[model samples]
Target: MASTKLYCFAQSGNAYKAALMLALTKSDWEPVFVDFFNGETRGDAYRATVNEMGEVPVLVEADEKLSQTGVILPYLAEQTGKFWPADAKARREVMRWIMFDNHKFTSYLATYRFLHAFAKSDPPVVAFLLARVKAAIAIVEKHLGTQPFIAGNEPTIADISMCGYLFYPKEEFGFDIAAENPNIAAWLDRIRALPGWVHPYELMPGHPLK
Candidate 1:
Protein backbone atom coordinates (compact mmCIF):
# COMPACT_ATOMS: atom_id res chain seq x y z
CA MET A 1 0.00 0.00 0.00
CA ALA A 2 1.04 3.56 -0.67
CA SER A 3 1.79 6.00 2.11
CA THR A 4 -1.01 8.30 1.01
CA LYS A 5 -4.56 7.44 -0.08
CA LEU A 6 -6.80 9.80 -2.04
CA TYR A 7 -10.55 9.23 -2.06
CA CYS A 8 -11.74 10.44 -5.45
CA PHE A 9 -13.55 9.77 -8.69
CA ALA A 10 -12.51 10.68 -12.22
CA GLN A 11 -15.24 13.23 -12.91
CA SER A 12 -14.47 15.51 -10.01
CA GLY A 13 -12.14 18.43 -10.73
CA ASN A 14 -11.97 19.27 -7.06
CA ALA A 15 -10.64 15.79 -6.47
CA TYR A 16 -8.26 16.15 -9.37
CA LYS A 17 -6.63 19.12 -7.69
CA ALA A 18 -5.23 16.99 -4.86
CA ALA A 19 -4.49 14.09 -7.15
CA LEU A 20 -2.44 16.39 -9.36
CA MET A 21 -0.50 17.66 -6.38
CA LEU A 22 0.32 14.13 -5.26
CA ALA A 23 1.39 13.15 -8.76
CA LEU A 24 3.50 16.26 -9.37
CA THR A 25 5.25 15.84 -6.04
CA LYS A 26 5.93 12.18 -6.79
CA SER A 27 4.25 11.17 -3.54
CA ASP A 28 3.53 7.53 -2.88
CA TRP A 29 -0.22 7.67 -3.18
CA GLU A 30 -3.03 5.45 -4.37
CA PRO A 31 -6.51 6.46 -5.49
CA VAL A 32 -9.57 5.09 -3.70
CA PHE A 33 -12.41 5.40 -6.18
CA VAL A 34 -15.73 6.70 -4.93
CA ASP A 35 -18.87 5.95 -6.94
CA PHE A 36 -20.16 9.45 -6.71
CA PHE A 37 -22.66 9.27 -9.53
CA ASN A 38 -24.14 6.21 -7.86
CA GLY A 39 -24.95 8.17 -4.74
CA GLU A 40 -22.10 6.75 -2.73
CA THR A 41 -21.13 10.05 -1.22
CA ARG A 42 -24.57 10.44 0.35
CA GLY A 43 -24.47 7.07 2.07
CA ASP A 44 -24.36 6.81 5.85
CA ALA A 45 -21.29 4.58 5.83
CA TYR A 46 -19.31 6.96 3.67
CA ARG A 47 -20.31 9.95 5.76
CA ALA A 48 -19.26 8.18 8.91
CA THR A 49 -16.02 6.57 7.80
CA VAL A 50 -14.61 8.90 5.16
CA ASN A 51 -15.55 12.57 4.88
CA GLU A 52 -18.58 13.85 6.67
CA MET A 53 -18.57 16.84 4.34
CA GLY A 54 -19.71 14.42 1.58
CA GLU A 55 -16.96 15.32 -0.83
CA VAL A 56 -14.34 13.54 -2.85
CA PRO A 57 -10.53 13.98 -2.85
CA VAL A 58 -10.01 13.22 0.81
CA LEU A 59 -6.33 12.70 1.51
CA VAL A 60 -5.42 10.03 4.05
CA GLU A 61 -1.92 9.71 5.42
CA ALA A 62 -1.37 7.65 8.56
CA ASP A 63 -4.06 8.86 10.94
CA GLU A 64 -4.44 12.23 9.23
CA LYS A 65 -7.39 12.47 6.87
CA LEU A 66 -7.72 15.85 5.17
CA SER A 67 -10.72 17.08 3.21
CA GLN A 68 -11.12 20.00 0.79
CA THR A 69 -8.60 20.72 -1.92
CA GLY A 70 -7.72 24.02 -0.32
CA VAL A 71 -6.49 22.10 2.73
CA ILE A 72 -5.20 19.09 0.83
CA LEU A 73 -3.12 21.11 -1.63
CA PRO A 74 -1.27 23.07 1.01
CA TYR A 75 -0.76 19.99 3.16
CA LEU A 76 0.70 18.01 0.27
CA ALA A 77 2.89 20.92 -0.73
CA GLU A 78 4.12 21.30 2.83
CA GLN A 79 4.74 17.57 3.13
CA THR A 80 6.59 17.11 -0.17
CA GLY A 81 8.14 20.58 -0.51
CA LYS A 82 6.73 20.93 -4.02
CA PHE A 83 4.25 23.20 -5.83
CA TRP A 84 4.57 25.79 -3.08
CA PRO A 85 6.42 29.09 -2.97
CA ALA A 86 9.66 29.38 -1.03
CA ASP A 87 9.24 32.96 0.15
CA ALA A 88 6.52 34.02 2.53
CA LYS A 89 5.47 36.85 0.20
CA ALA A 90 5.19 34.51 -2.77
CA ARG A 91 3.24 32.07 -0.65
CA ARG A 92 0.77 34.85 0.09
CA GLU A 93 0.38 35.50 -3.62
CA VAL A 94 -0.29 31.80 -4.22
CA MET A 95 -2.87 31.75 -1.48
CA ARG A 96 -4.62 34.73 -3.03
CA TRP A 97 -4.96 32.91 -6.32
CA ILE A 98 -6.00 29.69 -4.62
CA MET A 99 -8.76 31.48 -2.76
CA PHE A 100 -9.91 33.12 -5.96
CA ASP A 101 -9.92 29.75 -7.63
CA ASN A 102 -12.01 28.15 -4.89
CA HIS A 103 -14.49 31.01 -4.69
CA LYS A 104 -14.85 31.85 -8.38
CA PHE A 105 -12.69 30.12 -10.94
CA THR A 106 -13.14 26.39 -10.22
CA SER A 107 -16.46 26.86 -8.51
CA TYR A 108 -18.15 28.51 -11.45
CA LEU A 109 -16.57 26.32 -14.08
CA ALA A 110 -17.25 23.06 -12.30
CA THR A 111 -20.86 23.93 -11.59
CA TYR A 112 -21.42 25.10 -15.13
CA ARG A 113 -19.92 21.98 -16.61
CA PHE A 114 -21.79 19.65 -14.26
CA LEU A 115 -25.10 21.23 -15.18
CA HIS A 116 -24.32 21.60 -18.85
CA ALA A 117 -23.08 18.06 -19.30
CA PHE A 118 -24.61 15.85 -16.66
CA ALA A 119 -27.36 17.43 -14.59
CA LYS A 120 -29.62 18.50 -17.46
CA SER A 121 -30.36 21.68 -15.61
CA ASP A 122 -32.84 24.31 -16.66
CA PRO A 123 -31.68 26.86 -19.21
CA PRO A 124 -31.85 29.85 -16.87
CA VAL A 125 -29.77 28.23 -14.13
CA VAL A 126 -27.21 26.92 -16.60
CA ALA A 127 -27.02 30.33 -18.27
CA PHE A 128 -26.36 32.01 -14.93
CA LEU A 129 -23.58 29.62 -14.08
CA LEU A 130 -22.17 29.87 -17.59
CA ALA A 131 -21.94 33.64 -17.32
CA ARG A 132 -20.26 33.38 -13.96
CA VAL A 133 -17.86 30.84 -15.36
CA LYS A 134 -17.00 33.05 -18.29
CA ALA A 135 -16.44 36.05 -16.08
CA ALA A 136 -14.17 34.11 -13.72
CA ILE A 137 -12.25 32.63 -16.67
CA ALA A 138 -11.81 36.06 -18.20
CA ILE A 139 -10.14 37.31 -15.06
CA VAL A 140 -7.62 34.45 -15.16
CA GLU A 141 -7.19 34.79 -18.90
CA LYS A 142 -6.16 38.42 -18.56
CA HIS A 143 -4.01 37.69 -15.54
CA LEU A 144 -2.15 34.93 -17.37
CA GLY A 145 -1.50 37.27 -20.27
CA THR A 146 0.85 39.11 -17.93
CA GLN A 147 2.43 36.15 -16.12
CA PRO A 148 3.45 32.63 -17.05
CA PHE A 149 1.53 31.20 -14.10
CA ILE A 150 -1.18 32.31 -11.68
CA ALA A 151 1.09 33.46 -8.82
CA GLY A 152 4.22 34.14 -10.92
CA ASN A 153 6.53 32.50 -13.44
CA GLU A 154 6.73 29.25 -11.47
CA PRO A 155 3.87 26.75 -11.24
CA THR A 156 2.35 26.61 -7.77
CA ILE A 157 -0.65 24.99 -6.09
CA ALA A 158 -2.63 28.00 -7.30
CA ASP A 159 -2.00 26.96 -10.87
CA ILE A 160 -3.00 23.40 -10.10
CA SER A 161 -6.14 24.54 -8.30
CA MET A 162 -7.15 26.99 -11.01
CA CYS A 163 -6.67 24.39 -13.71
CA GLY A 164 -8.74 21.68 -12.04
CA TYR A 165 -11.73 21.95 -14.38
CA LEU A 166 -10.09 23.19 -17.55
CA PHE A 167 -8.76 19.85 -18.75
CA TYR A 168 -12.12 18.17 -19.26
CA PRO A 169 -13.51 17.69 -22.72
CA LYS A 170 -14.78 20.78 -24.51
CA GLU A 171 -18.12 19.09 -25.07
CA GLU A 172 -18.62 18.85 -21.35
CA PHE A 173 -18.53 22.66 -21.24
CA GLY A 174 -20.56 23.06 -24.46
CA PHE A 175 -17.69 25.21 -25.82
CA ASP A 176 -13.95 25.28 -26.34
CA ILE A 177 -12.20 27.15 -23.54
CA ALA A 178 -8.66 26.70 -24.81
CA ALA A 179 -9.37 27.90 -28.34
CA GLU A 180 -11.03 31.01 -26.95
CA ASN A 181 -8.30 31.80 -24.39
CA PRO A 182 -4.78 31.81 -25.79
CA ASN A 183 -2.93 32.67 -22.61
CA ILE A 184 -4.75 29.98 -20.66
CA ALA A 185 -4.00 27.56 -23.46
CA ALA A 186 -0.31 28.34 -23.22
CA TRP A 187 -0.34 28.00 -19.47
CA LEU A 188 -2.09 24.63 -19.73
CA ASP A 189 0.51 23.54 -22.22
CA ARG A 190 3.26 24.35 -19.76
CA ILE A 191 1.51 22.41 -17.03
CA ARG A 192 0.98 19.45 -19.31
CA ALA A 193 4.69 19.44 -20.08
CA LEU A 194 5.54 18.93 -16.45
CA PRO A 195 6.70 15.56 -15.22
CA GLY A 196 4.15 13.12 -13.71
CA TRP A 197 1.23 14.98 -15.24
CA VAL A 198 -1.78 12.75 -15.96
CA HIS A 199 -5.28 13.28 -17.28
CA PRO A 200 -8.04 12.92 -14.70
CA TYR A 201 -9.66 9.94 -16.44
CA GLU A 202 -6.38 8.02 -16.47
CA LEU A 203 -5.25 9.11 -13.05
CA MET A 204 -8.47 8.19 -11.20
CA PRO A 205 -11.14 5.56 -11.59
CA GLY A 206 -14.90 5.93 -12.36
CA HIS A 207 -14.98 7.58 -15.76
CA PRO A 208 -17.83 7.52 -18.36
CA LEU A 209 -20.41 7.80 -15.56
CA LYS A 210 -21.89 4.39 -16.26
Candidate 2:
Protein backbone atom coordinates (compact mmCIF):
# COMPACT_ATOMS: atom_id res chain seq x y z
CA MET A 1 0.00 0.00 0.00
CA ALA A 2 1.36 3.37 -1.05
CA SER A 3 1.49 6.15 1.51
CA THR A 4 -1.37 8.66 1.32
CA LYS A 5 -1.60 12.21 2.59
CA LEU A 6 -4.59 14.52 2.71
CA TYR A 7 -4.28 18.27 2.87
CA CYS A 8 -7.26 19.33 4.98
CA PHE A 9 -8.64 21.23 7.95
CA ALA A 10 -11.18 20.10 10.53
CA GLN A 11 -13.97 22.61 9.90
CA SER A 12 -14.42 21.95 6.19
CA GLY A 13 -17.21 19.49 5.43
CA ASN A 14 -15.99 19.30 1.85
CA ALA A 15 -12.69 17.99 3.15
CA TYR A 16 -14.59 15.70 5.49
CA LYS A 17 -16.23 14.04 2.49
CA ALA A 18 -12.85 12.71 1.43
CA ALA A 19 -11.61 12.26 4.98
CA LEU A 20 -14.68 10.25 5.91
CA MET A 21 -14.19 8.06 2.86
CA LEU A 22 -10.63 7.39 3.93
CA ALA A 23 -11.82 6.41 7.37
CA LEU A 24 -14.67 4.25 6.09
CA THR A 25 -12.42 2.44 3.64
CA LYS A 26 -9.88 1.82 6.40
CA SER A 27 -7.13 3.42 4.33
CA ASP A 28 -3.70 3.90 5.87
CA TRP A 29 -3.63 7.65 5.40
CA GLU A 30 -2.39 10.72 7.21
CA PRO A 31 -3.57 14.33 7.31
CA VAL A 32 -1.68 17.52 6.55
CA PHE A 33 -3.76 20.25 8.11
CA VAL A 34 -4.35 23.46 6.17
CA ASP A 35 -4.52 26.64 8.22
CA PHE A 36 -7.72 27.79 6.56
CA PHE A 37 -8.92 30.22 9.20
CA ASN A 38 -5.70 32.20 9.01
CA GLY A 39 -5.99 32.66 5.23
CA GLU A 40 -3.75 29.71 4.26
CA THR A 41 -5.78 28.60 1.25
CA ARG A 42 -5.63 32.14 -0.15
CA GLY A 43 -1.87 32.36 0.08
CA ASP A 44 0.56 32.07 -2.82
CA ALA A 45 2.59 29.26 -1.28
CA TYR A 46 -0.37 26.90 -0.93
CA ARG A 47 -1.58 27.67 -4.44
CA ALA A 48 1.85 27.18 -6.01
CA THR A 49 2.48 23.79 -4.42
CA VAL A 50 -0.51 21.94 -2.99
CA ASN A 51 -3.40 22.96 -5.26
CA GLU A 52 -3.64 25.74 -7.77
CA MET A 53 -7.30 26.04 -6.88
CA GLY A 54 -6.17 26.90 -3.33
CA GLU A 55 -8.48 24.35 -1.79
CA VAL A 56 -8.49 21.91 1.07
CA PRO A 57 -8.82 18.11 0.82
CA VAL A 58 -6.06 17.49 -1.70
CA LEU A 59 -5.40 13.76 -1.71
CA VAL A 60 -1.83 12.96 -2.63
CA GLU A 61 -0.64 9.51 -3.60
CA ALA A 62 2.94 9.19 -4.78
CA ASP A 63 3.27 12.38 -6.87
CA GLU A 64 -0.33 12.64 -8.09
CA LYS A 65 -2.75 14.99 -6.38
CA LEU A 66 -6.54 14.98 -6.52
CA SER A 67 -8.95 17.66 -5.29
CA GLN A 68 -12.67 18.43 -5.27
CA THR A 69 -14.92 16.33 -3.04
CA GLY A 70 -16.99 14.92 -5.91
CA VAL A 71 -13.93 13.67 -7.75
CA ILE A 72 -12.06 12.62 -4.65
CA LEU A 73 -14.95 10.59 -3.23
CA PRO A 74 -15.53 8.60 -6.42
CA TYR A 75 -11.80 8.06 -6.93
CA LEU A 76 -11.46 6.68 -3.45
CA ALA A 77 -14.53 4.50 -3.96
CA GLU A 78 -13.09 3.02 -7.13
CA GLN A 79 -9.67 2.54 -5.60
CA THR A 80 -10.96 0.91 -2.44
CA GLY A 81 -13.88 -0.92 -4.11
CA LYS A 82 -16.04 -0.02 -1.18
CA PHE A 83 -18.81 2.46 -2.02
CA TRP A 84 -18.91 2.49 -5.82
CA PRO A 85 -22.02 1.54 -7.77
CA ALA A 86 -22.45 -1.98 -9.14
CA ASP A 87 -23.39 -1.10 -12.73
CA ALA A 88 -22.99 1.61 -15.32
CA LYS A 89 -26.54 2.88 -14.85
CA ALA A 90 -26.09 3.07 -11.11
CA ARG A 91 -22.77 4.79 -11.69
CA ARG A 92 -24.50 7.42 -13.76
CA GLU A 93 -27.13 7.82 -11.11
CA VAL A 94 -24.41 8.36 -8.53
CA MET A 95 -22.75 10.96 -10.72
CA ARG A 96 -26.07 12.73 -11.24
CA TRP A 97 -26.57 13.17 -7.50
CA ILE A 98 -22.94 14.16 -7.04
CA MET A 99 -23.39 16.87 -9.66
CA PHE A 100 -26.54 18.07 -7.95
CA ASP A 101 -24.71 18.12 -4.65
CA ASN A 102 -21.80 20.15 -5.99
CA HIS A 103 -23.96 22.64 -7.89
CA LYS A 104 -27.35 22.90 -6.23
CA PHE A 105 -27.36 21.18 -2.84
CA THR A 106 -24.11 21.77 -0.97
CA SER A 107 -23.21 25.02 -2.71
CA TYR A 108 -26.11 27.08 -1.43
CA LEU A 109 -26.13 25.59 2.06
CA ALA A 110 -22.38 26.05 2.47
CA THR A 111 -22.61 29.68 1.38
CA TYR A 112 -25.57 30.38 3.62
CA ARG A 113 -23.89 28.82 6.65
CA PHE A 114 -20.67 30.69 6.04
CA LEU A 115 -22.37 34.04 5.61
CA HIS A 116 -24.85 33.48 8.40
CA ALA A 117 -22.37 32.23 10.96
CA PHE A 118 -18.69 32.56 10.06
CA ALA A 119 -18.39 35.29 7.50
CA LYS A 120 -20.93 37.68 8.94
CA SER A 121 -21.35 39.38 5.61
CA ASP A 122 -24.02 41.78 4.45
CA PRO A 123 -27.63 41.10 5.47
CA PRO A 124 -28.96 41.09 1.94
CA VAL A 125 -26.31 38.61 0.85
CA VAL A 126 -27.05 36.38 3.83
CA ALA A 127 -30.79 36.56 3.07
CA PHE A 128 -30.21 35.62 -0.55
CA LEU A 129 -28.10 32.62 0.41
CA LEU A 130 -30.64 31.61 3.06
CA ALA A 131 -33.36 31.54 0.42
CA ARG A 132 -31.23 29.30 -1.76
CA VAL A 133 -30.43 27.13 1.25
CA LYS A 134 -34.10 26.52 1.95
CA ALA A 135 -34.81 25.77 -1.68
CA ALA A 136 -32.01 23.21 -1.86
CA ILE A 137 -32.98 21.61 1.45
CA ALA A 138 -36.61 21.31 0.29
CA ILE A 139 -35.52 19.49 -2.83
CA VAL A 140 -33.40 17.03 -0.85
CA GLU A 141 -36.19 16.53 1.68
CA LYS A 142 -38.63 15.64 -1.08
CA HIS A 143 -36.17 13.32 -2.79
CA LEU A 144 -35.21 11.52 0.42
CA GLY A 145 -38.92 11.05 1.17
CA THR A 146 -39.00 8.09 -1.22
CA GLN A 147 -35.44 6.77 -0.89
CA PRO A 148 -33.06 5.61 1.77
CA PHE A 149 -30.09 7.40 0.20
CA ILE A 150 -29.40 9.92 -2.53
CA ALA A 151 -28.01 7.73 -5.33
CA GLY A 152 -30.03 4.61 -4.59
CA ASN A 153 -30.98 2.22 -1.81
CA GLU A 154 -27.32 1.98 -0.83
CA PRO A 155 -25.05 4.68 0.49
CA THR A 156 -22.74 6.20 -2.13
CA ILE A 157 -20.47 9.13 -2.76
CA ALA A 158 -23.57 11.17 -3.55
CA ASP A 159 -24.87 10.82 -0.02
CA ILE A 160 -21.45 11.75 1.31
CA SER A 161 -21.37 14.79 -0.92
CA MET A 162 -24.80 16.20 -0.06
CA CYS A 163 -24.58 15.39 3.64
CA GLY A 164 -21.47 17.52 3.93
CA TYR A 165 -22.07 20.78 5.80
CA LEU A 166 -25.45 19.51 7.01
CA PHE A 167 -24.06 17.71 10.08
CA TYR A 168 -23.01 21.02 11.55
CA PRO A 169 -24.72 22.27 14.66
CA LYS A 170 -28.06 24.00 14.20
CA GLU A 171 -26.96 27.10 16.09
CA GLU A 172 -24.24 27.64 13.51
CA PHE A 173 -26.93 28.51 10.99
CA GLY A 174 -29.48 29.66 13.57
CA PHE A 175 -31.78 26.86 12.39
CA ASP A 176 -32.58 23.30 13.40
CA ILE A 177 -32.81 21.11 10.33
CA ALA A 178 -33.63 18.06 12.45
CA ALA A 179 -36.70 19.94 13.73
CA GLU A 180 -37.67 21.33 10.33
CA ASN A 181 -36.80 18.41 8.02
CA PRO A 182 -37.67 14.99 9.34
CA ASN A 183 -36.88 13.13 6.16
CA ILE A 184 -33.38 14.59 5.94
CA ALA A 185 -32.85 13.91 9.63
CA ALA A 186 -33.72 10.26 9.16
CA TRP A 187 -31.42 9.98 6.15
CA LEU A 188 -28.57 11.55 8.10
CA ASP A 189 -29.13 9.09 10.88
CA ARG A 190 -28.84 6.23 8.42
CA ILE A 191 -25.54 7.54 7.15
CA ARG A 192 -24.36 8.06 10.71
CA ALA A 193 -24.88 4.38 11.40
CA LEU A 194 -22.48 3.32 8.67
CA PRO A 195 -19.22 1.73 9.79
CA GLY A 196 -16.39 4.14 10.69
CA TRP A 197 -18.76 7.07 10.94
CA VAL A 198 -17.20 10.02 12.77
CA HIS A 199 -17.89 13.68 13.18
CA PRO A 200 -15.86 16.05 11.01
CA TYR A 201 -14.39 17.73 14.05
CA GLU A 202 -13.35 14.40 15.52
CA LEU A 203 -11.90 12.95 12.30
CA MET A 204 -9.69 15.86 11.24
CA PRO A 205 -7.18 18.13 12.97
CA GLY A 206 -7.02 21.85 13.92
CA HIS A 207 -10.26 21.83 15.87
CA PRO A 208 -11.14 23.51 19.21
CA LEU A 209 -9.71 26.65 17.57
CA LYS A 210 -6.65 27.54 19.52
Please provide, for model 2 over 1-210, each residue's C-alpha lDDT reduced to its tens digit, 9 standing for 90 to 100. Answer: 449999998878889889888988889999999999899999999999989998888999986699998889988988988888879899999999899888987888887887787888899998888888888889989999998999778998888888888788888888998789999999999989999989888889998753
Cα lDDT tens digits for candidate 1, 1-210: 998899999999999999988888888989999999889999999999998999887999888999989888988888879889889999999999999998988888898898899898799999999999999989999999999999988999999999998899999999999999999999999999999999988888889754
Each candidate's root-mean-square deviation in Å? 1.2, 1.5
Clashing pairs in 1: none
What is each predicted model's overall lDDT from 0 to 1?
A: 0.91, 0.88
Q: Candidate 2: global Cα-lDDT? A: 0.88
Q: Compute each candidate's TM-score over C-alphas.
A: 0.97, 0.96
Question: What TM-score does candidate 2 reach?
Answer: 0.96
User: What local lDDT does model 1 show for residue 12?
Assistant: 97
Residue 38, candidate 1: Cα error in Å is 0.8
